[model samples]
Target: MRIMAFDYGTKRIGVAVTDPLQIIATGLDTVHPLQIIDFLKRYMQTEQVERFVVGEPKQMDNTPSQSAMHVKGFVNLLKKTFPAIPVEMMDERFTSKMASATIAQSGMGKKARQNKELVDNISAVILLQSWMDRKIY
Candidate 1:
């Protein structure tokens, strides 16, 4: 089954999706918090997403940060928007750092690292891939 993943930020949300077999995850796009609900409403209608895996932000000490509250709110929005799909949260402590390292290793220009949306999108892909790797047998 296909799964949708989200990296929720204060201003923008990164999105990713797994294939129907849940083997590979791909970065989709980053949307403004204000537009996320509408965007997902349309996306879910077209894409065959069976579930949602939202990244749960926590500090290096494993303490929940204030950002987690915003993520919870977004999770509520996802539940209201796609009531049929089950939503789960996976710890996203180091996704941003991992994404940055991945991008730098790819030899992307510094300008790309400055792009919050791009970074967040790749972070979402990492988050989804981690979730799939951990949860899939």
Candidate 2:
């Protein structure tokens, strides 16, 4: 089984998944908000997912951000859609900025750093990795 993470957005949702061994997270795909469940269904057909980790955006004070409402609604939908699977919310503060910095530092070039989809993908990876890190200590 694998652990999946999502950096949810109203427009685009970034996806990442851990290896079967739960060793590391890797970028999967950027999915449309409307199509995410279907996309996940198709992915589940071939891959056994152990849990779903959704990014919960937060403000500097650690309160829920404006996007938190949307994320909560999405989480409800996700639970309804996949009743057996457990879902978790993780703070996503600065994941995007971190991703952007990572891209800029990676020397993937100017155009690559400008790609929101790429940034989202990396953010999801970071979210999952953060979760794993928290579990360790």
Q: Per-candidate TM vs. native?
A: 0.95, 0.97
lDDT of 2 by residue, 28-128 (tens): 99999999999999999999999999999999999999999999999999999999999999999999999999999998998998999999999999999
Q: Residues 41-80, candidate 1, lDDT per residue (tens digit)?
A: 8886777889899999898899998898999888998888
Count of clashes, each model: 0, 0
The candidate maximizing TM-score is 2
Clashes of 1: 0
Off by over 4 Å in 1: none
RMSD of 2: 0.7
TM-score of 1: 0.95
In candidate 1, list every pair of residues with a backbone clash: none
lDDT for model 1? 0.91
